[model samples]
Target: MSGTSAGAPEPEGALEPEGAPAPESAPGPRRRRVPRRERERQILDVAVQVFAKRGYHGASVDEIAESAGISKPMVYLYLDSKEGLFLACLRREADRLVGAFQGAATASGASPELRLHAGLLAFFAFVSEHRDSWVVLHRQASELSEAIAAAVAEARRAVMAEVADLVRAGIAEGGPATQLTDEDADFVTHALVGAADSLTDWMARHPDQSPEGVTLRLMNMVWVGMGRVLEGEAWKPVTG
Candidate 1:
């Protein structure tokens, strides 16, 4: 008598009829919305991994999107095209590399030489820790088109300028021999960057070598020589 009748009003949010297909099971949980910028970054992160693993021509928007758990069209929507995605990876990695160098080199209170050493150490550390990023930035050069080349060049120039400034500062301080020009500084920058670029490969071959050791060796070889050059000693190339 006290129990509700069969036709009594059903409570709100009650279960569906026993055999009536379970009313679609309440939609599990809503997927939290990712903001556009965050979504783009997530897409880019997956893109970098794929691009690193597969060169530009080989990498596909489909795989990158799937890896990112998104649709291919969504990748295009976020990055425009595969080329755009590669460019984005290049720029982001380059910015990160540049930021690492600048942040280390500009560190307060250390001597100029130490700051420069710190910067080089930071470079090696970054390359070591971010092998995929380095691969994307370094190895992807072979796939360059106009925009890709330009993005790569821009990153190179930014790093060169930072090193050149340090070189110029060193030249200014070294007594009476502070005659280094911007051109001279750039020449040094090219050599240093080139060597560092090559060393990334060497680093891959020698995983046991620590970044600090690598940095020290490079500084002893290059930075010491750099100081001598800045002081106008001029270690000219050997001629037979």
Candidate 2:
């Protein structure tokens, strides 16, 4: 008997006729080309995570490219350079955070207290959702080059300005009883922003707390003192 295996024969309906063109193989799935804006967003998203995780000095374009599933040259083509990429990430996240605050603060024709509360809630919600972005903006950017530091400072100032506007508006709306001077309002804005930044870090460490909960705590601490100050009562140090 021949040594050929019976299983090797072509199955019924599986064979093509001789001299006929070979059956065309099924075309592989087409690679969808992402839109320019979307691709840039994807690159920035990966860049933010890489920068946040590794810090600017530790992070590399090659690593970001690999993680983003694109080539180094492509990243450069899109973002110009490593510094440029980091700047883009910083600007994007900063805008997003600021936008959230503005949107919430201007949501309704309600009281300043309500607007401030909404802004705080939005701020905490953004921090909770974009922890990497917060890390990149808060921790990593400051340690980077001077240009990046300046850019970050500008973003911070923008956020502080927005909060300051809210504080000023609150004083105005509170009428003559709220005796906060422009200087006092500025100082209060700084305190509120600084406290919120610190508490954001604290919230990261204690993830069990909700954003609303954190917002409420901050509102309670800030508004009570603010109310007292607005009503012409200021805290004084005890004289020895």
Q: Which candidate leads in TM-score?
A: 2
RMSD of 1: 13.8
Model 1 scores a C-alpha lDDT of 0.76
Query: What is candidate 2's lDDT per residue for 39-87, written digit by digit as tens?
Result: 6667788988999898888999999888877677677766667788888
Error of 2 at 26 (Å): 16
> Can you tell me which runs of candidate 1 are displaced by over 4 Å?
1-27, 108-110, 178-181, 229-240
lDDT of 1 by residue, 23-55 (tens): 112457755455555666777788888888988
Q: CA lDDT of each candidate?
A: 0.76, 0.80
Error of 1 at 159 (Å): 0.3
**What TM-score against the true fold does each predicted structure earn?**
0.82, 0.83
lDDT over C-alpha atoms for residue 239 of model 1: 95
Residue range with the least summed lDDT across 10 consecutive positions in model 1: 16-25
Over 4 Å off, model 2: 1-32
